[model samples]
Target: MNKSSVTVQPLRNTQTKIAIIGGGVAGSTIALRFAELGLDTTLIEKGPSLVNGPPICHLHAGGNLYREISDEQCLTLLQQSIETVKVYPQSVNVRPTVIALPKTDHGQPEDLLPRLEKLRKRYSELVSADISNKVLGEPEDYFRFYSRAEVDALVNKSIPSKATQASDWLISFANFTDLNKLKFPVLLVQEYGLSAFRFAAIASLAIERLPSCHLQTHSQVTAITADEDNLGWQVSTKLQGNDNIQQQQFDYVINACGFKSGEIDDMVSAKRQRMVEFKAAYVAHWPQCQGLWPEIVFYGERGTPQGMAQLTPYPDGYFQLHGMTQDITLFDQGLVASSLQSAQPKLAQRFIEKIDKKWPEQLIHNRTLGSIEHMAQFIPQFSSAIVAAKPLFGAQQIPGDDPELRAADVSFHGKHYARAEIVKASSALAAADAILANLSECGLITDPAIEGYLTEHYFPVSQQCSDIEVTERAILLAKQRDYPDALAKNL
Candidate 1:
């Protein structure tokens, strides 16, 4: 429980040691796997442990396991996450809720039905194959289909009328009925608290379960040098509150410093170019009212960038109204308040309205308003303009005489961007999920591996888009998609 002290030590010749920078889920999971494999591991964290540090990204452990990862990996992480929950019950949380497919508010009856059917089939297949326990129940009992009217009734009663709609309909599911079934502990439910809890619990378990591993905090690794004889790495770091710099040599280095991924790539080989930049934003939370909606609403265009808002329930008889805006300037208190007041003036007023409509005697007190500032400070932005068709499976075509098909070296942009590689928003999450799954499946960490593939790739990168173009496109798409619901409603 002690904080890492500021000290400098000279490099010492020692056995191969693994250095893991960043204490988030990816970094900690890798560190634990390395330690379990009998490697001398050191985990460097920029922040304090979960209990004291700010909230980490709230992730549905099961959701990430299911959609973002492979079937094998999903099962493994699910078991590991469950075990972590058992050991640290106070650090984990779960709720019974269904996750439905994205739906359109106004669409052809058949169009929405087929999409819903596809989602249902996929969900059933996943549960049958991946879920450990199986229970027979009606569709609504397990996962129900609600009409637009039904959805409206639920939201009007459960959520404030003024709040922005984040998504359509609700899918509710259950959690581990018995905490005793888990090996780790489960924490209280909060926004994005599960991912943070898992990160902490796994780190704690690794430190306790593996004696050879050491975790260091406030150590910023600035540079790395590879040893010639073994191609190992010599890592140099600047310790907080200390004048002397420290350097240590290790047989291997795992670069898990997210957002600074490009920086780490610079320290090692220069073959890999930094292709992504990250941006951060703020999420605001509003008061919860009785009869509030239970659906996970997503307000925004399908393809363009747009703000999102949702209502997640907490155990303490309170609902959390969560919203995200892309404009960083709107992240400030004054701007946020003004924006909300202007956009949804009735959001605050709806508390009284809801009380009058639903629970009459319930006097709402201690209306606390807070924001998850920098919950996920960075969302990745890829830098590529070219788009190529996905590789065809089982390809065997050779036009040897054609000059365009000649076997020769080709170059672009002074370096290859992996040849027609496409970037997507869900790529990072999918990759992380797969990595965790593999770690669990393999029973330990091995060489560097790439998992997860991008879908719905974008070109020209978000950064290259001129401000006017980005704004115009976003506005057009938002209107077309009825984004944020409120914006669409106003329009």
Candidate 2:
């Protein structure tokens, strides 16, 4: 008997539906992509707005902060950072980063030369491939070196009203930093800063304008199950204040819940190994400090008394600080992992309270002060800085329990489910592209227009919002979220 050939029908753009849980940067990026493609998509977020999770101040274009990561990881970060900046151009703080090593540090300044050269070459290649990819100025001017004598000379020079050259951005740091403590020939890389608030505003505005994408905020997912018909999955969610449950069905489900992505994994009985970490950055105001400063990184050992200290400058004399010591940015038992019983890693109730509610004033004071003193060792004037507002803190998920891991994208469980475990916000778009490719391979996306659009597209809706509009909305968002409005504005 000849077996009848099974007729498999490809789904149309309207027939294929996607449900993205968790409205953090990852979920928001995915929703934006699907929306631009004119596909049926639903984005469910438990928070009041999108991108309301962890602190995102640095755009690691070259992955220079973490010296332990591989060069491959650095290249990936460079590509993703460029794409992110293109998507949210208004959010980028166009300033160079000063990477300095104190006398107490073990690493040598010469050790970074190889990686810097590699990054410069790769950047040149990207620019050559496409002229518009030259976002970080010139590829030849990607990084610069300054000797101790050069820095000392700049201490007396006046700060540039608008920093055009690499040396122009180094005046403030050279004036404040203790020259005796740092190694010679410090590095100034093209790595810039990212405004989390501005990124959030742009993402929210772009998603709102898309009619095909439905955004549900202050909504929590309760349960999920495979439908009896075997065509899709059913998701149950409850509003923040209501107990009544509402259910929705989708052909494909994406778990992009950020640090709580493991919870979604557990709901579907999908066992996975992961870890969650809680970290914070404090805000301080130095009214007496003059001139614009670049983002400063004083490298040190992590989890020790002298961990890495980062100083991120904002407008209006406000600066964001992070000290990796236990008393400052890191807390006791702040990092936890999934156990044999469940895939969800348990964070302490206190940390969870900080994320869900407000941080106690005492805790904020002590931590902010600690971070100030930590930076004062290198920049004595920083000791006079006062706490500006509440610290930006949240729990971030790390896949496979390696806390030092910096590069990650997306993972697939089955044919119908995709989980995004992106370690950095810059990796969000790449993760979205992976999910889109997965849907195409599964025969779920059959639209010719969508296919042609995906072939050579980096960003489809880059010009959706004007700079003035993004700034106005981002400042409002920062104030509403209990942060200093300066945090939303670039320096």
Candidate 3:
């Protein structure tokens, strides 16, 4: 296929044209929202598909994983997660999460109560405001405490065939975990799992049906410059395996390129302060471990010998694992910041190689086995779990230097440009809404149709797919990406 420069001439009195850079969660969400509003939109993705950046298995509903973050951030996360679920209900894996503190940790379970209580109360209020906001289950069941004796009682019992209630999800955990190694009164919260691949499937399929939205995969944005009239932007893109460039003009440009947003910022001479961190999650197939399981979190100090360990379960006994230690999920110099001269942060080339090319088999084996060993400290049976496939990993961008920052939306540069710097996957929709609000303020959108869409009962344009269709497409996407088909389906 020969590539040639094709310019999109600015139309007179036409619908607002939007060019969204990157096809990750944030960009895809913004494009979908714009297309739903009947705006002429183009989604440019460097990869073959969408949402293929960092692996986001766990939805940080209530921000339970990060105890250091403020309660306000936790509440924001709760609200964002609710909105995300409403928009992509088919992408959610309906399961709870177990949060426990090991004996080696300094903090107690009581340290978590205040936040949990606040989350529960907020959840109750949201449900009261709109009954459908009860996506995390009944507010009363937002979180439940399990005393040591109660958990100990199930230590000798068999794992339930299927987990119906929150406690039922703990049978295997209680039986397999070394009870003495953990603190008392473990809490099970209503946080759930999100399949990135499934989300990509939904967004791509939905965009394909929208007449106003153009989906361009394998098209990388090479250069961006303001038009001579100063009314719009001229975006130059290069197709994969092609030397020629194609330039297009749009009324507005959104930088949503995940960790590479700063590159675009530099292209437009927009000053920014950002950090990028590379992280990975291992896939382990433990077929012998029968029965359904809730996602488990063992909190410890980050970047230490005893760091946070996460076990996320998928269908068919395939478990996704994350260890916050440097030897496992994190790496030395994995987190880097932008320099004074350039807006983009420089990660080590080895990480860039892994991101752009394939990971060496030896390195995959070492890190994955290391992740398995990290989990085996609490659950001994997990030691028998072998590496299932290549890890799900990518570099994520933190808008500011604060690594602990969890809740963020979109930031605007000028009247016609916006940058989405969401820290969590749940925050994608909120960022898109912020962009829409900015567009309205800039007079690009005179009349907004989906105001307060999150709280209302109306369906999103992307909700055209039935549950079964979403499942089938998601599973096919997983297989195409070289992941196990089970990862796309819920347990």
Candidate 4:
């Protein structure tokens, strides 16, 4: 990626300014881009900091994008997010997640290598670099299929009979039984894990660190009205800490306030109802133990695939295990805390029992939600459990629904702008592009003399928040060769 050689003048109408509501990944990245372009940007977050804590707020990124979107889009956005997150004040652990696939028929362990090799042949550009004995793949290189032996080596533990019985490391079905097989490939993927506080901390830092940007934390937006006088909108903000009220104007406004987007848009648009579904999960921490746990996403061994269980480990020896409930959700920020605490341990505990029985019980020291939990009886480190709510997929909404997100890869332009589908962190990358397009379209950021300057130099990598593994793994497959350019494919 190239950096611009020329200086940029302030992009927006100097007096009106640009008010960005929300400080999550979507809003923060948008703020980062406008600021870099030399725009006078004001970012407002209702919370004390960008990422407020867990009455809600513990979040995860990676794999979801890699698996759901195209390889080009996934890799590019992931790279950008990785870079931006490096500056997060807290620790961001880089870990490769392993997804298990269960076998239905008896297949040799040798069969796993061929499958990955075939993927390698098909997507030569996606392969990771090798490290002497093991074949590496993307995140940095090609995602690989690890054998059971390799899995054992990764965990530094001997293969248990339950593990050894499976020819491979995958468990495809949602539910496993004595009949289901385990002799297939386990997907080894590169992913990142960090506290939402850390994620938000870095994002807030990016907004404030930019010379042209002003970050207003704990600033609640009370109203937005048309200011045809200035050909923009008048914004009313109540400074929570000072109890002071201030009115400002912006040439353009972007609503990236997550679930509350519609609630905020009510000042100008129609009213829309918001909803969120509940999900149960458990977490625990072990003392005096070195955590080498690989994040594992399990499918199932039962009939058709059941939902998966995602296990993430932190630097603080706090290991979180959740999943089982899948699909999207819509949440109300105010209810997140009480709801999670009120959740029963049924789902999370059932997931633990359904997956494995070998976990040693009695390692319980702290339980986050309840006194007696089923997971504690099997896993020594099993602590407390709770349920969480998330914004449902395709849930971002505004009253008028002017700037739509039918397809979220880009932005839609209207009186007020928004990246409507950016409910997750990864969506921020592409949504940033959409926001820039809107800014440029609204004439708030006009720099035609160096027209392609920003897009050419920074767009490719702006979304990254942390350092990334840099390598140009070339495309080698026949089908892949036909496309010729790997950059053309994006989701």
- TM-score list, all predictions: 0.47, 0.96, 0.95, 0.60
Candidate 2 local lDDT, 158-221, one digit each (tens): 8766876679889998888998998989999999999899888888777767666799999999
What TM-score, to 2 decimals, does candidate 3 have?
0.95
Writing each residue's lDDT as its tens digit, candidate 3 over 1-491 gives: 01112122222243788999999999988888777656789999999988998989978889999998989999999999998898888889988999999999999999899889999999999999989788999999999999998898777677887766667888988988888899989999999999997898888778777666798999989999998877799999999999899999899999999899989999999989999999999999888888868899999999998999999999888999999999999999999999888889999999999999999999999999999999999999889999899999999999888888889978889669999998899999888888877776678776544345422423355786677777888888888889999898867
Candidate 4, residues 1-491, lDDT tens digits: the string is 22243334454443437788887656776777667667778888886555331212222333231233344443344444443343332324444466554353222435344434443443343222322112222322445655555544434333221333222223311112111235544566444454443344345434544566788887899888887654588888998767777998777788776645554556655333332223223444443334244455554321222334455544344445443332211112311211222211112343233222322232122222232132232233443333211110112322222222112333343554553435345455567666666666666665673357444325222234342211111112211222122111110
Question: What is the TM-score (0 to 1) of candidate 1?
Answer: 0.47
| lDDT of candidate 1 over 1-491, digit per residue (tens) | 22222121211222455676665544655554444434467877655441112223333333221232234333333333333333233333333232322232222223323333443354456456645222212222333444444433443333333324322213121110111211111111111224232334434543544555687777778887767763466788887777677898765555554434434555554333322211221222222223223323233222123333333443322223333443321222211111211211122333224322321222111111211221111100101111111100110111112211211111111211111111211122233333334333433333333122111111111113233333343334334422221111110
Backbone clash numbers for all candidates listed: 38, 0, 0, 48
How many clashes would you count in candidate 3? 0
- C-alpha lDDT of all candidate models, in order: 0.33, 0.87, 0.87, 0.44
- After superposition, candidate 1 runs with Cα above 4 Å error: 1-16, 50-92, 96-142, 149-198, 205-209, 271-295, 302-306, 315-324, 328-491
Q: Point out the worst 10-residue segment of candidate 4 by lDDT.
A: 469-478
Worst 10 residues of 3 by lDDT: 1-10
